[model samples]
Target: MPTVLVTGASRGLGREFVRQYAAAGWQVIACARNPDTMGDLASDSTVLQKLDLLDPATITALANALVDRPIDILLNNAGTMGSQSFAKHGLNVQRFGQSDYADWEHLFQVNVLGPMRMAEAFVEHVAASKRKVIVTLTSMVGSMATNAAGGLYAYRSSKAAANAIMKSMSIDLAARGIIATPIHPGWAKTEMGGPNAPLNPVDAVAGVRRVIDGLTPEKAGRFWQFDGTEMPW
Candidate 1:
């Protein structure tokens, strides 16, 4: 069975990924800040690990613990949109003239720096696997060519930085036969997407899994939507 290390496995898309992958007989390293919160998702095929993207020590510890393991896929799925609730306040808190440096810093820590740290720590594990792939869940709001509304400054910028990191990783890790890319999960009806969003977490995650299933060397370093469309930079 192929092994996958997934970050932010407590809820939302991360939880869904765990469910789908485990059901398909994959060995899943499901990581979350609080493993207890994973609840009934625990199974014989899943190993829950405590992980906090904000803390480098936790990341290093997990990487060290799994040093001998070969991870087929390193899924950087943990991220943040700041303290404000998008469901209630919408993008008002992230709008122009409302920028909070502290919140912005937190966003960058989780969305941008976290994935970079994960890639650096787990490069060996991925390279040693038969299917070496690194996937970061980014957003289309990060796309410079697609930006029109221009509101979510912090969240948008952090995802944009993440996209850049994935692109560079694809080039840098090519010698190791690792395929790295950023994928947009779309506006799903999750805690961040608000209740009115069209896509549900099940379908959204399913679509992303399809995209990951089809990843190839030629497809690395590009932005992709959940529906398999190539997104603009």
Candidate 2:
């Protein structure tokens, strides 16, 4: 069976990805901050591993434990919108002065640095697989050309940095035959997207899976939408 390693599998789109991949007969290595909290992922076929993005030891440990295993895909889905202050339900697009510096630091650490570290740790595992792919969950707001509304300073900036990181990784890891790209899952209904989001987690996950399944080396480093459209960087 093809093996996939997914982060942030405790809930939301990550959870949906785990469920779908496992049900389809894929060997899933699901990582969450608290593995015990993910009772829904308790399947005989899925291996739930505890992963704290803020902790490097855990990341290194997971990589070492799976050193001999080939991972077809590594989904860097673990991230935060920022501290739940003014942007809990939806993003708070206030004036530039309303920026939270502390939240910005935290967001960058989680959304940008964490995935880069993940890629570093598991690049070999993905390279050894039959289908070598590394996918990072980015956002449309990360696109500078698409910044029409202007706001979400912390969240937007971090995602943009993440996009840049993945772009660099795509080129650097190409010799290893690994495809790396950033993807936007659309305005899905989740804790971050709020209740009235246009897309649901199931549909968004399905669409993203379709996009991932169709990825080619030529498409590496490009920003993509869940619907398979190429996004502007």
Q: TM-scores for all candidates?
A: 0.98, 0.96
Q: Could you give candidate 2's per-residue lDDT for residues 71-176 as a string of tens digits? A: 9999998888876533344555534887778878988889998999999999889999999999999999899999988878888888999999999999999999
Clashing pairs in 1: none
**Candidate 1: tens digits of C-alpha lDDT, residues 96-148:** 88889999999999999999999999999999999999999999989999987
lDDT of 1: 0.94
Return the number of clashes found in candidate 1.
0
* Candidate 2 residue pairs that clash: none
Candidate 2 lands at a TM-score of 0.96
Each prediction's whole-model lDDT (CA): 0.94, 0.90
